[model samples]
Target: MKFRILLLFAVAFLLLTTTRLRVHAQSGKSAARPNIIFIFSDDHAYQAIGAYGNKFAKTPNIDRIAKEGALLNNNLVTNSICGPSRATLLTGKYSHTNGYKRNDRTRFDTNQTLFPETLRQSGYQTAWIGKMHLNSLPKGFDYWNILPGQGNYYNPDFISQPNDTTRYKGYVSDIITKFSTDWLDKRDNSKPFFLIVGHKATHREWLPDLQDLGAYDNVNFPLPSTFYDDYKGREAAKQQDMTIEKTMRLKQDLKVDADYDKDWTYNRFDPEQKKVFKAYYDKISKEPAEKKLTGKALTEWKYQRYLKDYLSTANSLDRNIGKLLDYLDKSGLAKNTVVIYASDQGFYMGEHGWFDKRFIYEESLKTPFVIRYPGVIKPGSKVDDLVLNIDWAPTVLNIAGVKIPSDIQGKSFFPLLNGTKATAKVPWRKEAYYHYYEFPEPHHVFPHFGIRTDRYKLAYFYNGADSWELYDLKTDPTEIANIYGSKGSEAITADLKVKLKQLMNQYQDKEALQILAGAKK
Candidate 1:
């Protein structure tokens, strides 16, 4: 009996020792993985960011990211629309593959796997704060406080876990920043975290914060050179309804309440809110009425008002970013956390006489992407290689030492950051494919798909209107001239079509393939 008792005691001691060792090994592995913070904003054009050379705006906090880390000069989006771009960033796949192609009130199919889910499974705590306009509750996140639909600019309602919404009072940008920091305070420090701070500032119907109402009042923005584009060569450009002159309204967009033309936007505000808004806008409204501005003068006046409000909204966004960066520094998380700033897609700030995004134009196609990885990436580095929104997932997974799924369409560009050779010496993609499907409603941008190389761009506008447009980017950087069927352009056009077809096949875009076939016939 004594011998049996001694043997049982020895076995129990061995089991305890093994368990403790396993726990210690797991803790060490988690500590080695770097934390990730992805900051996303809506309708923020790369041209508006000071880091990207916007002389009209001040973005010191955003510029700091570029100064501290790497800037992706050629970061482009697969789609230029809102929800589709967000879907692509999460799934690392195009809109067709993810089944959220258009923003016509379609719900994001959350059943499919997302990169955040992969991170959560790998023992990382995940949380998403602020706008995630997916029309569905976010999956794979342990904690989420998101906005419903586009969310209000003031006193937005944040939808929390277990499906409950609570209204918070403040500017949307400031409220989002506060929730993000609060989440950080309550998070489990034992495990590494991946947090997404999404902001809804600078979206259409640009409403500046009350404090920022008169921020840019002193500045008068110059008109874009293409503000008077005749649409002489481009058929699709002529048919769209997103023009700054015609589509933008004085009461609805510019907040000029001259006659009150039944504007529903202002009706949404409460009595107190309306009083404050009227006090500020009513004073400015009298000037335009007194000037009796028309034609060039009227357009120029509208441009200044639009720019002032847009820049004021952007000012709040930049200030909030500073707050988050300060928290990281004070909390000692700056050394190990990888901070990333990006947008769902770029917007048009009076480029080509347009006010909305959905075209495959340069202003809307390119987004600002800045990253700061303290130890891994060298400071002030600039990557000129073409990168897409779809690459975000694979890159983040690779950074966390997580194995990227084989089915993800995007290839990780982590090698570009760390200066390491890929295990497989595959060539990087030299061109990017773009497709926009939303049309005939809202902005009325035509459905088109195209390919963009370093020096050229070719597009096919189909969906009732069959046309081809090509640009020699080196000679026509502004894309003012269409050289598709022009003389001496046969070789380049044929080459671009071949490359476009190859990409369509690679991505398995059956709709695009059918369209290409029809266009060829």
Candidate 2:
């Protein structure tokens, strides 16, 4: 009887040990999945970053991502508009297919398969915290605290799940950081996490935080060489209403002679915030009236003010990025976490005498994209491949070990990050396709579609401005001269047109195809 009792005890111990080992192995497997944090900013120009060769701009925190991992030089956008760009990101499709081509009154089709839902199904906790301009409630996120449509820079309101909105008191950048970290702290530890820290900084009417008001006051920016563009060949350029001279308002945009009590932008500021803001701007407001500036002098002054305000507003954005990086390090999540920094679309920083985005031109087309995926991507790597905003969703899904749906138009550049021989060496697309649909409203940039190769750009503008513009990018890097129908450019123009049509057909852009068909007739 004693021997039998001892045998039973031994068997019970063996069973318990096996169960513990199985559970431990499962936990290890779960922990191996990398956590993803996408730090998305609004209208952040690539030229305004330190990593992208901006000597004057102080973007150390964003530069850190480039230093640690990869910086994509030619990361272009599919449709260079605010809402449409974001919709393309969520769906991994172009603007037309995603059904959110323009920034006006269209709602994002939440019923469609968003990449976040795929991540969640694969056991990752997904969330989006900050500005999401898609005029609808977030559907796939487990938790989302989004700004209500072009959120204010000071004391903004965030919309949560079940349509709950709470006012947060602080600079918009700072508030977004706090809420993001708070969510990170409270999330379930067992599952891997994916968070989108959407920022409204560096957008239109650039308003800096109180501490950052006069940050760029000492720095004098030089005018862009093409500041006084003749718009000789490009009819679209001549028709645009986005130039800094004419579009940017002094009292409203630059805050010269601003009404503290009446202006909606300033009314949200609390007493202490208001006092600091008023003290700074009131002193600067007297410049225009005192100088009685006019002609080129007035235009140049506006350019200086625009750069100062825009860069100042970006200060808080970079600082908050540092905060998030610090948090990841402190929490021991740094090793397995992937941090990505990018913008909705690139903005114009006195490039071509413009202030806003929405063109297939270099400044507005190519945005900043940096990623830090430790242990996988080699440090200080630079990818000059033609990756688009549509690729973002598939890349994120790939990082989470989730299967990308067949409907997603983007191919994952994950292989590019890892530098794997098998997939990385696969032939990538040589030419990038671009289309802009928004017409004659905010910027009045005419609707256009085109293809950009390494050495050339060919575009066809329509809707009352029927014209074809081609630039030999190798010679005209600044795109000063359009060589369309030029003596030597017939073959290249014909080639680009054929390739553009092929891309449109491949992407299943029916509307664009119809438009192209009509243009040909």
Candidate 3:
């Protein structure tokens, strides 16, 4: 009886070993060529993620990305506008260096040796799945993307490369994820792959999936004390077009059925939405503009609408991210592939009484950066070093063994990932230099330049004139009080001005002279 039992155990052990070998063999994933996937979302703020200290935003999958890898607590961008930010990500250069400082600026020059182009040369099958808000067509990527101008919430159209544009009939978030996962399924397995999965959620006129429309409607969100900012000491912050009270869209724009003139709808009307509105308005009832929405009630209504719509959009995107992660594990690609989740730039969610980005404040200055490289990064490690968006290209290039271009302004942070060094320590930019140039835009944000160190930040807003705003970040994390002209601030401002100029020169910025010349006072 004992011999019989031993025989049974031996057979079972052999079977288990054989099964494991067969599973590994049949998976067909390469151990050497690591797949890199960048999941980039639009205007998705760091503070909204569960891992990033947002007490309320439901982002289980985004939080998982951080759990499985490292979370960058101090990520920043050279220029915070959408187009310029994309350019910086692609080229690893600042907006001025990349020649894409303004939304109105021309397309990125393809003449340079882009990271994807290098990866393509190295035989990686690269594909971009969605939302390249590029004014000029994409280049250098092995798979070119076709997304909506800003992408849409429903019935999104994706134009494929070599002249293949297909309209997918579904929500934008799902469509992008499906296409990306589908691409992953059918990719040339002979070569490793790099895919950029971009989402159109949480952008301007935040819309949600049909399932998420009524979320956060019951719980009344507390009003920001700065919500009713009179703009007393903030000369430039007052001129911004991101105020929740001023620039936020209402009614049809927000997908809310309300008693207001439909003509006043603020969101960019989709061609399909126009048709729906015309048919509804021509046959059905029109909402009159004579609605008496008193002060507090009106503001609360807007806040509810904003949270319900915005969080709903985030829900879809996070759900889709989960789908991709599942694919990695189920397909046995988790061990080799590297996954990165980030936003184009940080966004304002009623922080400092604002919604849109393009400010040097904490909400807009800091973006969410999470990465999962199964072997290299330990689970749930958080790094609080200032990293620029441009650093992304070089970091990927370093991981892939492709050389970084001398002209690129960014250095790779790959070493920091493996717990080798402090990211912002070695080539330690004493302070990060930032510039925003799209003025009178959809958000009339004036052009500005600033410097941020470990504790202090100084900014100059010049809308053809000159105005300076300084903040002691340690005391005033909210930036409600600008101490630029305050007495006893001259010494710190002067020190920050010198560091700013030195950085601008290091970055080859010609505009740094403007700051230095104005600092003579």
Q: Model 1's lDDT to the true fold?
A: 0.87
lDDT of 2 by residue, 1-521 (tens): 99999999999999998887665343222237899999999999999999999988879999999999999999999889889988988999988788998999888899888998889989999999999999998878899999999999999999998899899899999999999999999999999999999999888889999888889889988888889888998888999999888999988899988887998877888999888988898889888778999888999999999999999999999999999999999999999999999999988888788889988889989999999988778899999888999899998887777899999999888767777634336677788989998998998999998899888898888998888889988889778798988898888888888999999999988877888888842
Better of 1 and 2 by lDDT: 2
- Write down the TM-score of every candidate: 0.92, 0.93, 0.86
| TM accuracy, model 2 | 0.93
Task: Report, for every candidate in turn, its global Cα lDDT versus the true structure.
Answer: 0.87, 0.89, 0.77
Better by TM-score, candidate 3 or 1: 1
Q: What ranking of all candidate models by TM-score puts the best one first?
A: 2, 1, 3
**Candidate 1, pairs of clashing residues:** none
Best candidate, lDDT-wise? 2
Greater-lDDT candidate between 1 and 3:
1
